[model samples]
Target: MGEAIIFKLHLVLGTTIFLLFPFTRLVHIFSGVAAPVKYILRRGYQIVRKRT
Candidate 1:
């Protein structure tokens, strides 16, 4: 019976974090980690034209 109570508490906390993850600053952590990999994988250098 005690183990079931602990399991329920874990489920509640996990659901809360999952729901709140997008609105919180915690999301920046994922973008910061992914940005470098995305840049590295992107194709081609940006073209810049000089004014005549």
Candidate 2:
């Protein structure tokens, strides 16, 4: 119920999510990269083709 306890809980959960994000099926993690890369490569339209 204290501020310190809340901080600790957030730190723990954030660390866990950061550690697991890259190794799992949740690769929207890379959408951050895709957006910029799409601008340079002009590949924005290819996302659908690549997925199918």
Candidate 3:
């Protein structure tokens, strides 16, 4: 009985975190995953000039 209660609590907390993940700072995970793709498709580097 105790194990079943703990299992249910674990599932509830896991589902809550999954639902809230995208609304939290945790959403940055998607950005981090896409960064490499973005960099690969980005335009050429900017040219810099030295000031006299």
Candidate 4:
């Protein structure tokens, strides 16, 4: 009985993780582009501002 319960818990947890994994990738798909643009703009700003 204990083994069966453990097996069922493992199955449920595994399925939950597997199902959620791909949607998590949506974060990178949507937000990934803005980061590099911000980095480049900030670097350019520092270059101009440093002269003063």
Q: List model 1 lDDT by residue over 1-52, tens digit each.
A: 2578889999999999999989974564566768767756767778999999
- Top candidate on lDDT is 1
Across 1-52, the per-residue lDDT of candidate 4 in tens digits comes to: 2568889999999999989978873444455668656644553334445555
lDDT of candidate 3 over 1-52, digit per residue (tens)? 2568889999999999999887875454466778767766778778999999
Better of 3 and 4 by TM-score: 3
lDDT score, candidate 4, position 19: 91
Which residue pairs clash in candidate 2? none
- What is the RMSD, in Å, between candidate 4 and the native fold over all Cα? 9.2
Tell me, what's the RMSD of every candidate? 8.8, 7.4, 7.7, 9.2
In model 3, the worst 10-residue window by lDDT is 24-33
The 10 consecutive residues of candidate 1 with the worst lDDT sum are: 24-33
Q: Rank order by TM-score, top first?
A: 1, 3, 2, 4
**TM-score of candidate 3 against the unseen true structure:** 0.50
Could you tell me which residue pairs clash in candidate 4?
A: none
Model 2 vs. true fold: TM = 0.46
Estimated TM-score per prediction? Answer: 0.52, 0.46, 0.50, 0.41
**Model 2 lDDT, full chain set:** 0.71
The segments of candidate 2 whose C-alpha lies over 4 angstroms from its true place after superposition are 1-3, 28-52
